[model samples]
Target: MKTIKNENIFFLGVDIGSTTFKAVLLTPKGKVHHTVYTRTKPMPDAILSCSGECHKCGRCNLGAISKTIDDFLASAGIDRENVACTITTGSQIVDGLVDFIKYDAYVSEISAHVAGARHYYPDVKCILDVGGQDSKAILFDEDMQMWMSKMSGICAAGTGAFLDSVAAKLNVPVEDMDEKVNYDSKLQVSSICAVLSATSVNKFKNRYPLGDIIGAACRAQARTVMSGVGELFLDYKGPIVFQGGVASNNAVGYYLKEITNNEIIIPEFHQVMGALGAACLAAELYEKKKKKDASYEEKSVFKVGVDELQQIIESVGGTPLAKKLGGLKNKLFVHKSDNGLEKIGIPSIKQVKDAIGDVHLIREFTDIFDKVVLRKPATDKGYFKKSIAMRANITRRELFSRNRDVPMVWRNLFYPPEILNAFGARTVTLETYAAFRARNPKKLQQCFDRAASKGYSAETCSFLRVLEGDEKLPTPDFAVTTTEPCQQGERIFADLVRDYNLENKYYTLHTPYKLSEHSVEQLAGGLRESVKEMEKAFGYKLEHDKLAEACEFSNQAREYAMQANEIRFTSPPLIHGSDAILNALVFSPGWGKPEFVELQKTFRDELIERKKEVELYTNIEDTHRLVWLHLPPFYSKKLMNFIEVTNNAPIVYEEVNHVGWDILDVNDPYVSLAKRILTVGFLDPELRVKKIAASAAH
Candidate 1:
């Protein structure tokens, strides 16, 4: 690579985002010299034919970026020789950029946005940036003087792309979307998904005026941001700076101001804040480097060969290597260090590997598992905590163990574990396994990609997608699923059976929607048939005595679970609901085992002991009690900790932890299991709502 020298008169920053290309030039004194912003364009077929071998294929976005830079320099009447340094940020910064433009440093999108906002308003405490592909919420801790950020998940809801889709569908120009807004519109757009929201807009276009539908879409975008990452702003005070391309949308700004009820500041260069921030960062770093060395060259910040750039582009477009290079380029430059003052250099290869690889994650979990299973429980710690560890240990040993001698059964969580216990088979609950794998995000994403390659739709339930992507899953002797709760579960199971050539061994129990004697008998008949099929496949007779024994164990476990729930209902927060929810075995295949019964007993006893001591498991004071409704993302605990520890809000109960059914009749195990499945709180809408209401009253 060639090194260039400059006279240190100007600094340049470029942001190559998913939807747009942006550039900003700044004078030595921090004044904006020039700026350029344009839509990002893809490489044309003629240019792509070169397969990136052409060093200067100016037909692609890279070429556009070069042109933008050239125009920026000419328009500002500045020469490259006078530019002290250049910094780059955004999603596509490293996509063959080294061949076109050289950057002295690179910064993350979050840090760049913060720098840009602080340049204009140093006291800005909160930032909500809704870009083309994703949204981010950044908060500045006054005491610590550090930046904290939350980003949206894989969904494109509330992003600029979502808005563009709605605009295109409504035949409204992108720039005119805000002007056509109906502020008082009472319509609603789905905030859960971008596709679904677009579908809603399509449906509404027929019934409602264009303005109302567009306004609802804008409101939905605001709501989506608030629900996903804006949870940080729940108790935040002071002015919030809204940055990014989407900030240009006045309707979104209006809805955000109305929702947050705070002063919203849109910087003079709102759409180019990231680029401005990068320029600011470049200026800061260049001065520091010159001062330290007395002689510093403007070296290329990123060095990517043709092959590496090709791989990066391919990964960005969702190839198998995507997870490996995802978010890596952003880490290639010096930026604000952990102390929030000092600048740090490039990260090591091992650090990158740890960030994206499953080895470290698996090892971390292994250490936890070893600590729980290999050592004696500490008397100082609550047994409820120990019980959770024990439950995890049981699950790890049973489901994950490779013991081909025992029949391996693939079953959904809704199916009774007691039936499999009678046959002495090891069970892998699809959802549970997915949750376990979710601990390693990169690995889980690989599974998702694999599933997508196998023709699974992106809209499929994430858990099922994970299963479909799972190439390491052991082939099961048989697979069973129920039709209740999740219809996708049975369909996915059938696909899995076909994939594994287990056609004769697959079973689906068609569970009825409503609970009645006739429904129970019908389900009971399906269960009986399934059991008979299993017996025939395994070449073993159905032992009534073993079935009855399994039911007795399940009943015992249920009693202990109920006792634990009663204690939780009456006492102060004894355990963090985050930890409590890990007792997934309560709803999984452990119910029929003696070890599960012991786990339940220990849990109940620990809660009783905690009640007597007047001690809270969470050392933090509980200012607010909350009931968690659904599953948490198993990938991270940051959200849970933020709620329970940072906000002092304790999730006292989780819906899944509730034991709502009565003891099973051991003599009539099939009928009892069928009744339990039918009456599950989650299966019945009215019952679920009533149970949630009753739990909240406690």
Candidate 2:
């Protein structure tokens, strides 16, 4: 082991999580000198003698965290000045150590765990950390020299806190839970929800032995971790390092081993791995600082001001018009600093290029259209693929472009776009916009963080959460939503409208769960009411002729789409399922437009040509035919590509593209639109299953 030459220097790490606070002190030789671990919200009696004054003493959390660090240093026989560097991590680290304690730096829980794991097991390939509040899995890709992580949603089912709750209910100490396990027990508890699992444990207490229930609960924890973050271990090799508070449970480790059929290694200090990792980071950063390395400075992605924006534009070889546009955009969107502009950390020219490439939205749009629409034939991209990409880009351009001539209506996917088109409006479908934004992963994550900061629950749909976090969403003239498959969609849309102070412009279609004539009539009535409200608000009369024309265009597009589907079903795999699933505009806003009809015709014609070509000489074998249910992830194509290209399993059909509804009745456009909305399978579980089964049969 390498040792630091400065014997007097020491490093400290503090991890403040939702349930616990941990501190680790390390010597100059990088060995743990002392450690402290305690609950974040410790009982007053546990910290000191209780005079029952804690209720009014709002600083109990802060006191506990400070006491832990103080005691840790005192026990180590080290003074605060002797500690060369200190770093912090965990969920509560940001706010927990504000006044009393100061830290040099902070790292994410995932990064901390990875660093800690690598300290002991340098070649570690995978890690699973199940803490009190959340769980995480980190996989190291040696080939790419990178790490990828997956975390549990805002749920406590698989976490240490959940197990502790179960232990308390069973009248058993959490430490002794592993010892009381009855491995032969057949009782299985629900791993999906913590509350439901607790309820199950309570119900089973009378029927089953205590040991059997404990065993089952432990098994449930392991299963939950496997189903949640353990998803990343699918392609993992070698032993899995298990860390965090939950790793102390031998029974859970046993089940993890059994489930994965791989070795599981629990570090001696598994509970404080995050703190250890932080300490390791502190020592490394301190060494860099000693050498006066510029890398020691903290780096973060920031919203650029005018000057930095200009530099970025010039770095990317921007045109004069582009530079002017960039400057205008920066002034409008980026925050201006009254102080001197902060220097951006440009590590290398490539990084500068990547930064500019990631955020140059207009440039990206121009490049995409130029490649897919203008240079389609030259690039060897199929006509259908080109058409899909072009249609998506066109919709994005229309929604994003500032067109003062038309009202921009924000709508849920369930609302028909044809009506908005008739009213001379551009539409922004929430899901489609989210998908478009997802093209830039870095920006999308910023949106997620922003949403979290705004108190949006992590359990909210990622699509809607993306919208909540998005500061760049175009202000809508009005908004509409449906109370059907997704109530969250309605809630979020309503919140957005409230935020924009456009209460009167907001509209919602109350869709019943079951489809019937009365329900359809009720929906039609709602649609008519919404149309009237829009007409009054925008000062434009609803013309029946324009609506009828839009519906006719939709009908023509529907015919072409049906033909395309038939060709896809009967013919060989010419189009990838990934590409087909992205034909979202068919279900999105512009179905009523002539361009959509042209897109559909081109799609159908391309499929026909591919079918003829395959029939002539190509002998493509039918491998695994998959029917994709629900929506594929919009953020990345890795999973889809792995299945289709790597595994040779073609996604034969997708439920989203299944044209199940009938052609719109142009004469009775409102009622027809209502009926079409009602027929959507997603609104009804039975209908969705039937559709899935039918698609599978093909």
The clash count of every prediction, one per candidate, is 1, 0
Alpha-carbon lDDT, every model: 0.76, 0.76
lDDT (tens digit, per residue) of candidate 1 on 308-409: 434444523543335445455454433466666453455433343345565433222222222222121223355466776887788897678878787888
- Span of ten consecutive residues with least summed lDDT in model 1: 294-303
Name the runs in model 2 displaced over 4 angstroms.
1-385, 616-621
The list of candidate 1 runs beyond 4 A from truth reads 1-385, 438-442, 612-622
Model 2 global lDDT (CA atoms, 0 to 1): 0.76
Point to the candidate with the largest lDDT. Answer: 2
Question: Each prediction's TM-score against the native?
Answer: 0.49, 0.49
> Native-vs-model 1 lDDT?
0.76
- What tens digits encode model 2's per-residue C-alpha lDDT throughout 15-116? 888888888888889898888878766536444443444323434556666667777788889877778778888988544354456566667788889988
